[model samples]
Structures are given as structure tokens and as C-alpha cells.
Target: MAKFFGNLNAVLVGGLAVLIVIMFGLHSAVLGESIYPNQLFRYLHVLCGIMWIGLLYYLNFVQVPTMPSMPDELKPAISGHIAPRVLFWFRWAAAFTVLTGLIVAHLSGYLVEALTFQPGVVLIGIGMWMALIMAFNVWFIIWPAQKKILGIVEASADEKAAAAPRALIASRTNTLLSIPMLYCMVTQNALGV
Candidate 1:
């Protein structure tokens, strides 16, 4: 058990297998085949969203704040090793979240109406737009800047100096946007907001 849990790839695959089993076990409620694309995409969206936002919070709440206080030598461990890997997952999760969300929206037949901010879907549309913007920030803004900041790309000293603040501000902007994004996602359907 410890060995399995210690291997992230194994853990993720095992967890997914368990989830599939549980879903199949609830056959009466799930009717898995009948709800294939829509349900599957929605599930993927939520799963990707959790990973995206979870990393965002980890960066904002834990990593960024803690960096300034770390010893310079220790900082390399995070900046060189951890940040790159985390950003890899972060950016891909952001992309997948948007992709799966669009798939779910299209499959449910409201992609146009929602994007147009039609009355019933205004809140979700707002959330979707916010998420799209955040994803853009993750991919185009944050990742590029992070590459420079983390030395994944060769940058002039001046460029590296510029990159850090750029990445930080974009990440902070996403963090701020996440609050309302989450609110809209949860409240849109439930409260008819």
C-alpha cells in the first residue's frame, strides 16, 4: 500500500480504477452507457478543474508566500525542481478543464446560448468566460513567463527579472478571478443566479 501510494503514477491509475469500479457499482443511478459523452466530459471537467485550481491555490497560498523566507540555497530546490513540474500539471490541467468544459457545454446543447450570455445561462457564461481567461493566462502568460523565471528558456538577466513579476501578477489575477469563477460555477444552476 505504501509503495503504491508512493508512486504518483500508480496512485493516480489506482484511484481512477477505483472510481470506475464505484461508478459501475452504482449502475442504477449512473446508467453509464446512456450518459456517455455528457457525463464523461462533465466528470473530466470537474476533475481537471480541481487539479487546476488546487495548483493555483498551492502556488498562491503556499509557494509564492513562502519563497521570500526560504534560504537562497533551498530556493533552488523549489524553483528548479518543484515549480517546473507543478507548472506542467497546472498548465495542462487548465487546458483540459477548458477543453472538457467546452465539450460538456456543447454536448448539452447550450454552447452558443451560454457563450452569448443568454438569460438562463448568464451566470455560467460569466464563469466560463472567467475560466477561459484564466486558462489563457495559465498557458500564454503564466507558462511563458515561468519558463523564463525558472530558466527553462534562456533569457537575458533583464528578461528573467521581468518575467518573475509578470508571472506573479498573472497568477495573482487568476487567484482573484477564481473566487467569482467558483461562485458562479456552484451557484449558477443551484440558485438560478
Candidate 2:
């Protein structure tokens, strides 16, 4: 059990196996029907969204604040190793979240209505547009700036300096948008809007 849990791949596979069982066994029994594509995409969307937003919060609430106080000698550990890994996951999670979310909306037959902000789907449309903007920031603005800030790509000292604020502002914008975005997503179903 220790060995199995110690390996990330093994743990992920185990978790997936459990999900398969629940989906086929419990879910089917409860719903009396197989899972639909929309449901699957919704699940994926929620999963990826968690990773993306969680990382975003971590960067804002923890990493950025802590960095200034961190000792210079120890900074490289975070910048050289940890930050790169975190950014890789962060950017990919952002991409997958958007992809899955769009698929969910499309499968649910609300892609056009939501995008266009039609009457009934106004809440979800707002959420979708916010998410799309955040994802665009993640892929285009933040990631490119981060590449410079993290030394993943070549940049002069002045260039890296310029990148830092660009990345921070974009990330902070996403953080600000996340609050309302999440509210719209959660309340859309509950309010029956």
C-alpha cells in the first residue's frame, strides 16, 4: 500500500480505477442510464478547473508573496526547479480546463446561446466568457511572460524585469475574475437560470 501510494502514476491510476467503478456501478445504478458525453466533459472540466485555479491561487497567495522574503541563496530551488514544474502544470491545466469546458457547453447544446449571452444562459455565458479570457491570459500573456521570468527562454536582465510585472498583472487579473467566474458557474444550476 505504501509503495503503491508513493508513486504518483500508481496513485492516479488507482484513483481512475475507482472512478471507473463508481461511474459504471454506482452512477449507472443511481441514474438508470449510462453516463453521457456532457457529464464526462463536465467532470473533466471541473477537475481541470480545480488544478488551474488552485495553482493560480497558490502563485498569488503563497509563491509571489513569499518570494520577496525568501533568502537569496535558497531562491534558486524554487525558481530553477519548483516554479518550472508548477508553471508547466499550471499552463496545461488552464488549456485542458478551457477545452473541457467548451466541450461541456457544446455537448449540453448551449454553446451558441452561452457564448452569445442569451437570456436563460446569461449566468453561464458570463462564467464562460470570464473563463475564456482567463485561459487566453494563461496561454498567451502569462505563459510567455513566465518563460522569460523563469529563464526558460533567453531574456536580458531588462527583459526579465519587464516580464515580471506583465505576468503578475495577468495572473492577478485571473485571480480577480475567478471569484465571479466561480460564482456564476455554481449558481447557474442552483438558481435554475
Candidate 3:
């Protein structure tokens, strides 16, 4: 048990298997059959968004802020190991979050409603577009820059150094956008657009 738990892939797979088994035995054979596909998709979108934004906050609020004061030797662990791995999750989470969110709107038959700037759905559209832009920046701008900065692939020292600030700025923009994005997503519905 301990050995199985010690391996990340094994633990993740094992835990998911346990969860599925429990859900099947305790309740319905298919867990999500009760909800509309859009509802399920939205729920999953929120889940992925949490991971994406949670890591974003970790990078911006915790890691980057602390890095400058750390010893140079310790810094490489962050730049090389921790960052590359965290970003793998971060960027992919952003991508799925956006993709599923769009699909959810489509599934709900709101894809046109949301995008067409109908008075009722426009606010939600704003939040969706915000998320889309941030995810785009995450996958296209930040990840590429971070690849260089984190040394996941070889780059000249100067190239690495150059990528660092550009990545940070893109991250900062996401942080700024995230605040209003959250507000619009929640209140957009509650407040009647």
C-alpha cells in the first residue's frame, strides 16, 4: 500500500478507481446522468478553472514573490523542476477549462445566446471571453516563455533571462483579469446580466 501510494501515477489512478467504484456502489451506475450535459460540463469547467487559477495564484502570489530572496542554488529547483511540472498542469488546465466552458454553453443551447451579445447573456459572455483570453495567453505566451525560463528545453543563458520577465508580465495580466472574471462569472447569472 505504501509503495503504491508513493508513486504519483499509481496513487492518482488508484484513487480515481476507488472513487468510481464507490460512486457506482453507493448510487447510480453513471454519476452524472442526472444533470444536463451542460451542467456537468460547467461543473467540470469550474473544477479545471480552480486548478488553473489556483496554480496561477501559487505562481504569482507565492513562488515568484519568494524567489528573489532565496539562495541561488535553491532557485534552480523552482526554475527547473517545480515550475516545469506545475506549468504542465497550469496550461493544460486552462485549455480544458476554456474548451469545456465553450462546449457547456453550446450544450446548454446558449452558445449563440452567449456570443451574440443578447442583453441577458452578454455579461456571462464577458467572463467567458476573459477566461478565453487568459487561457490563450497561458498556452501561447506564458508557457512558451516559461519553457525557456524554466530550462525544460535548452536555451542560452541570455535567452532564459529574457524570457523570465516576459513570462512574469503575462502572468500578472492574468492575475489582473482573474479578479473581474470571477466576479462576472458568478454575478452574471445572479444579477440578471
Candidate 4:
């Protein structure tokens, strides 16, 4: 339904449904061996990370850059409506991505190896740590500050003003860290993790 798709919960439910389908496909006969839950966890982590980072790029690369030029009336649609919705997805995706990533690493017998940055695990470990830090920033620093700045929840005028720069800095920091993190993720695998 139009109204259903328009809502955040609906969109999330849709993603979850897709995840379930992927798990089913992984188990289907034609796929050969059944994939472990840890393998599935890795897929979940990648999926959520994509959602979170993709939106972050959109906000920084497109929306924020364009906001000042837009009319005040148009601004509300973005700041008050669209941004809040996107951020809900952003923050939760960050949390779940981190959660699922850790679970996968542990289940796959890579956690300690990765954390210690053992020879074969170092690159991905770096990526994992970077992701953990980014997730922390998303949940603790950016989202809370954004709630005030975006007027999604009431805040004092002073608080609102303060929140904007704080949120921007945290988001930007995440962007910076993401580059190295992703490189390490790819390199680890490419190097035969």
C-alpha cells in the first residue's frame, strides 16, 4: 500500500522480509550446502551498513549541501520530516550492523583473532573497530544531537543551535573513518581472510 510504504516501520519490515528470503534461499536445495547463521550474520551486517552509510553519504553529499539554497518552506520537508525518518533508519541500522557483525565474528571464530590483529585478521579487525566506533557515534553522538537540531523533539533554542554543529561534526567524523574502515574490510578479504 502507498501509505504502508510511506511509513518507516513498513520499510524496515520490508528489509527484514528480504533478509528472511535471503536466508531461505541460502538453505534451498539448489544452493548446495546450507549456510551457517554466522554467514547469514555477515550478510546482515553488510546490508545494514550499506543502509546506514548510503544515507550518511546522501545527507552529507546531497541534502545538506543543497539545504541552504532551498526555501524555508521546503526546508521543513527535509529537516522536519524526511531527515527524521531517514535518521531513524540510520541509527537503528548502525546498531544492528554492529551487533550482527560482532556476532558473526564470534561465531566464525574470528573475534579474538581479529581483535588481536593477528596477521591474517588485522585488516578486517581494523575495519571492524572502525565500524564499532562509527556505530557508537551514530547512536550516542549524532542521533541524540540531531533530534534537537531537527526539531524532531522539543529543545531549547540554545540547545537546538548547539546540536547542529555537534551532530555535523560527529557525522563528518564517521564519514572520515568509514573510508579507511572499508578499505581494510576489502583488503582483508582480498588478501585471503
**Between 2 and 3, whose lDDT is larger?**
2
Query: How do these models rank on TM-score, best leading?
Result: 2, 1, 3, 4
* Per-residue alpha-carbon lDDT of candidate 2 for residues 20-138, written as tens digits (9 for 90 to 100): 99888877754544347778889999999999999999999999999999999999999999999999999999999999999988878888999998988999999999999999999
Q: What C-alpha lDDT values do all the predictions have? A: 0.92, 0.92, 0.86, 0.85
Weakest ten-residue segment in model 1 by summed lDDT: 26-35
Clashes of each: 0, 0, 0, 0
Q: Which regions in candidate 4 have their CA more than 4 angstroms from the true location?
A: 1-26, 29-35
- Stretches of candidate 3 exceeding 4 Å from the true structure: 1-35
Native-referenced Cα lDDT, model 1: 0.92
Q: In model 1, which regions exceed 4 Å deviation?
A: 28-34
lDDT of 4 by residue, 1-193 (tens): 8998899898989988987797677666544444566666777888988998898898889987899899988998898789988999899988888888888889878898998888789888989989988998998889989888887688999998898888889899999998999898768777855
Ranking by lDDT: 2, 1, 3, 4
Model 2 residue runs over 4 Å out of place are: 28-35
**TM-scores of all predicted structures:** 0.94, 0.94, 0.85, 0.83
